[model samples]
Target: MVSQLDNPNLNLIPKPSHTVKGLIHIFTTAHRNFFTDVMAQALRIAGQGTPVLVVQFLKGGIRQGYKNPTQLSQKLDWIRCDLPRCIDTPHLDDSETASLRDLWEYTQKVVTEDRYSLVVLDELSLAINFGLIPEIEVLEFLAKRPPHIDVIFTGSETPKSILDMADQITEIRRSHTP
Candidate 1:
C-alpha cells in the first residue's frame, strides 16, 4: 500500500471550529473562612478586565442590595442581601425573608442577562440548606444560564445534586496541629 503521507489533498481539509464553553466549579469547606482563595480568583479575573459578579446570599448587616452593588473594580460587582445582620439560621423575619427573595430574584435576572463572564454565588449552599432559596429553582437557573458563563458556588455542605453537576469540585480541609 502507498504511504498516506504522500497524499497531496491533506492540506485541503477544513478545520472544525471550536467554541469555548464555561464550566461549573464548586468550592466547599467545613469552615467559613475558606473562601479566601475563591475571592482571590474573582479579583484576579476582574483585574484582567473580565466581568465578575459576587453575590453573598447569607451575608448582610451592610444593607447592600442588588441595586446597590459594591463595585470592586470596573469589571467586578459585589452584592449582598439588605438585612440588618448576617444569616446564621433558617429562621428569618418577614422583612429579612423579603430581602433575601429580592436578592435571589435579582441574581437570576442579571445572570440571565449575560453581562458577566464569571459569577460567584457565595454561601448559596447554606441558603439552600436553610430553605431560603429553593433547590429546584437553583437547578433550573443553572440549566437556563448562558453556556459561556462560568459559575462558582462556594459554601459548606453543598447538596449532592449540585456537587454532581459541578465540572470541578474543590474541597478545602484544615489540618489541626497539636
Candidate 2:
C-alpha cells in the first residue's frame, strides 16, 4: 500500500460551526393560578442580565395593556390585556377582543424582531382554547422566532401541538387540598 497522507478530498468537507439555540419549556397544570415557579425563573433570568418578556394573555383587571408594559427589571417587561376584568371564559366584548388582538400582535412582532432572550407566555393555553388566539399562528411564530430566544408557555389545558414542540414539560400538581 502507498503512503496515504496525500488525500485532497478530506479538505472539501466543511467544518460545523458552533451555534447556540434556545429551547421551548412548557409548564402545565390541571387548574389555573399556579405559575409562581415560572415567574421566579423569569425574574432570576432577568436578574442575570438576559432580556425577558412576560405577557399575560388572559389576565386583565389592571389595564396594563401592550403599550403600558410594566418593567420588572432593567431587562424584564411584563404586559397584560387592557381590560377591566380578568378573562375566564370565551365570551368577549368588542373592545376586549381588540385588546387581546393588539397584545398578541405586539408579542409576535417583538419576538420576531429578536427583542428578548427569553419570553414567558402566561396563560397562553387558555387564550388559545378560548379562541382568543389562533394556535396555527402561534406555531408559525414559534417556528420563525430567533434561534437564540427561549420561550416558556404556562397554563392549564395546554394543547397537544404546543406540548409536542416543547423541549421540557413540567406538570404541576397539588399534594393536598387547600
Model 1: per-residue Cα lDDT over 26-93, one tens digit each: 99998888778898999999999999999999999999999899999999999999988999999999
The runs of at least 3 residues in candidate 1 whose Cα sits more than 4 Å from the true structure, single-residue gaps closed, are 1-18
Model 2 spans > 4 angstroms off: 1-16
Q: What lDDT is reached at residue 16 by model 2?
A: 75
The Cα local distance difference test for each model comes to 0.93, 0.92
* TM-scores of all predicted structures: 0.89, 0.88
Name the TM-score of candidate 2.
0.88
Model 2 Cα lDDT, one tens digit per residue, 1-178: 7876877999998887855888999998887767788889999999999999999998899989989999989999999999999999999999999999999999999998889999999999889999889999999999999988999999988899989999999988888998
Task: Assess candidate 1 and give its lDDT.
Answer: 0.93
